[model samples]
Target: MRMHRIGAAMAAFATFAVFTLATAGAALADTAVKFALDWKFEGPSAPYFVAIDKGYYKAEGLDVTVDTGPGSVAGIGRVAAGTYPLGFFDINSLVKFRDQNPDKAVKAVLMVYDRPPFAIVTVARTGIAKPKDLEGRILGAPAPDGAYAQWKAFVKENGIDAAKVTIENVGFPVREPMLANGDVDAITGFSFSSYFNLQLRGVKPEDIKVMLMADYGLVLYGNAIMVNPEFAAANPEVVARFVRATIKGMQDTVKDPDSAIDSVMKRNETADRATELARLKMAIRDNIATPWVMANGFGAVDPARLAASIDQIAVTYEFTNRPKPEDVFTAEYLPAAADRMLK
Candidate 1:
């Protein structure tokens, strides 16, 4: 009886050891990828976290770590420097960055914001109602702000006299406060960001005006997922898997923003649940699910539209050598349209 018991115990131990080794081997097979985001842990960033928490990335044999960035423009540099294999940033900034570097292999892969969130936020008391109202008014704009980068283009498009407007170089933290305290008559930022932030600061909803740049003839795409060309070339499957997982996250976000905010709150402890939820929903309704994206599909851009946007960008930015749309973006890694369409 003792000998039989000993033999059974050894067999059980061997089976357990084999199972543990196989599990560890499978875990080791997963490719580790670090993802960079344009801004802090906020409503719009929830989808990526959702993908991580729900095991969407793991299912694709990827281990992705998402980190917050300083601003939309910073992610461009991060990806180009090979600090992160993938990042979300302003495509317009990426265009200009490529125009200057001409050597960096950073290219936008997924178009997240079909319509740019760039906007000029103001209050009714400021008497700034239209683009022309900005003239002679104090405008608080962060030097590195993605929206402010488009000011030149916006001014040219709307025929606003740029020289007449006094732009104050405010930090991102101070941009909204300056406007709320009446320190500056207007501020340039993302529509959803500035709008909600101002409301949180006691600024009434009816009083604020968000003049979205896209609404004012600035034909531009917003933030997109970018990748280092070398990394992408070496791991095309990994890139494809990353895109697929991200799109799955986006779909979940669009369908139930309320549930999505849970993911953001998990990362951002100080964030107001209601405020972040509102911001996430606004981003989805305004930027992510635009008519074009709804009709065509997500994660891709129209060639003609992208071409027009490039031409519009040239109005403010002088490029030494312009590049074709294909030079900056690719649909090579994107999943099929049927798979990407957000229902």
Candidate 2:
């Protein structure tokens, strides 16, 4: 009996030692990841803030820091240079990068906003009813890439002479005022944001005309989460967990948009509460809850849709060097939470 007691004690000690070592190893493996956002903290990126506020990243055993950068291209470039482990950017811009440097390996792991939000917003009094009306009108454009390319494609596809429309790089902040003061007859606006800002400024829905790019067959993916190809290959488990947590965040935002708005507002130091709230609500309704996103599962990308976008890019922008559709994005990392919700 004495011998058996001594053996049992030894076994218990060994088990405890093993358990402690395993726990320590896991703690050590939990790494910190830095994420760069393509733009300032706003509605479009509320889900990321929601995830952070709700401790989603912590739950995944990750220490995440989300920072805003100058633009999408800069964000992607930093990630490629290993300065940022992850980033959120325009899908079209990523494609442009691949076209410019085929040797640089990068891939978008998940698409946050499934639909493109680019639109042409004109005051109701302007009577710019269709794409054709854009002719001879001064229009505000963001820049010479990504959405601008799509805008130019829309003009050409519709038989509107690009020269007839004067393009000005008005930047995102001044787009609304430019239209209001008649500095530009129309401006490129995110369907959700510009619509809400105009309403808050006393422009009624009926008094405004919006030409959505998606309606003109310019259905491209925007605001995708991308990773370095090496990182993705070596740390798929970490990538998978991050994607899962992000999808859960998006679902939570959709279910309670008002609360999500508050969560996002808390992260913005210089954010105007009224304007941000309006933009958040509008983005949820017009951009997030659209048929395309609803049918395919939020943040889900269909290969066919991606192929169409790639084809459009090649034809429209002379991007003969674009990456193959399969290399651009992968749906494997998208959370099963969206699937569970579908049921």
Candidate 3:
């Protein structure tokens, strides 16, 4: 009877050990990723939250933690400095960074905004109806804003005297408010963001004029998922998984924006759901799901256009060393073409 009881006890211990190992194996399915965004929890950023809420990242074996950033430039710097392995930021700034730091350059993985959202927003009543009108007008922007970063490129190509245009360095939170209160004639901001934000502040849509720099001549690609090349080189599979998961999230967001907005509001309870929803739809229609993105699919760059833009960017930016399209973007880790098409 003693020997039989001892055998039973041994069996129980074996079962418990098996259960513990199995639980740990399940936990090891995905590696955690620290993802930083170019800005706060807002409409344009809602899709990433949707990805998290929808379990797309988990499905791809990525434990992604999405954190909001102060600005696009800051996001780029964070990723480049290795504070975060991945981030969403303005690709143009990456160009500048690559010029300055050749060896430690970050590469854009997923191209979110095919048509750059860089725009100069103004009140129509201010008589700043055209690019030329920006001359002699007080324009506002956060010093590190992506739109402001491209202001030189825009004003240069459009034949505007940038020097004559008075620039007021405003904080991101107060940019639209300052414009609405007549503190500044116009502001450099993302077209989708400042347009709706100004509208919510009682500035009529008709009163607002959004001159997208892309509409004028800036062939620059907008914000994208940037990875520290060192991280990407060491963990190629993780990078691919991250891109694949992001694709799922973006496509899901396109299909049902309301759900994406829900995910966004969850992260930021203070967000005005309706306002952010509207802002999101605008970004989808005008930037994310643009004609080019629709035809060519997402998560890939048009090499010719990228090359042309690099040359065009050189026209405005004095690069310490001119970087090529391949230096800034790569389509290698993009999943099979079918997985990339955004409906």
Kindly list the per-residue Cα lDDT of model 3 for residues 130-191, writing each as its tens digit.
89988888999898777887777788789999889999899989999999999999999989
What is the Cα-based lDDT of residue 81 in candidate 2?
79
**Per-residue accuracy of model 1 over 1-343 as CA lDDT, tens digit each:** 9999999999999999999999999867989999999888999998899898889999999989999987888778878888899999999888888888889868899999999999999998988889998999999999888899888889988889999999899998889999999999999999999999899789999999999999999889999999998899899999999999999999888888889899889988998899899899989988998988888788999888899999988887899868789878899999999998877
Please identify model 1 stretches exceeding 4 Å from their true place.
1-28
* Minimal lDDT window, size 10, model 2: 334-343
Q: Considering every candidate listed, which one attains the maximal TM-score?
A: 1
Better model by lDDT: candidate 2 vs candidate 3: 3
Clashing pairs in 1: none
The sequence of per-residue lDDT tens digits that candidate 2 reaches over residues 231-276 is 8788888888888777777778888777887777787868777777
Give candidate 2 misplaced runs (Cα > 4 Å).
1-29, 171-173, 193-207, 337-343
TM-scores of the candidates in the order shown:
0.91, 0.85, 0.91
Residue 88 miss distance in model 1 (angstroms):
0.6
Model 1 lDDT vs. the true structure? 0.91
Alpha-carbon RMSD to native, per candidate = 3.5, 4.1, 2.6
Clash-forming residue pairs, model 2: none
In order, candidate lDDTs are: 0.91, 0.78, 0.87
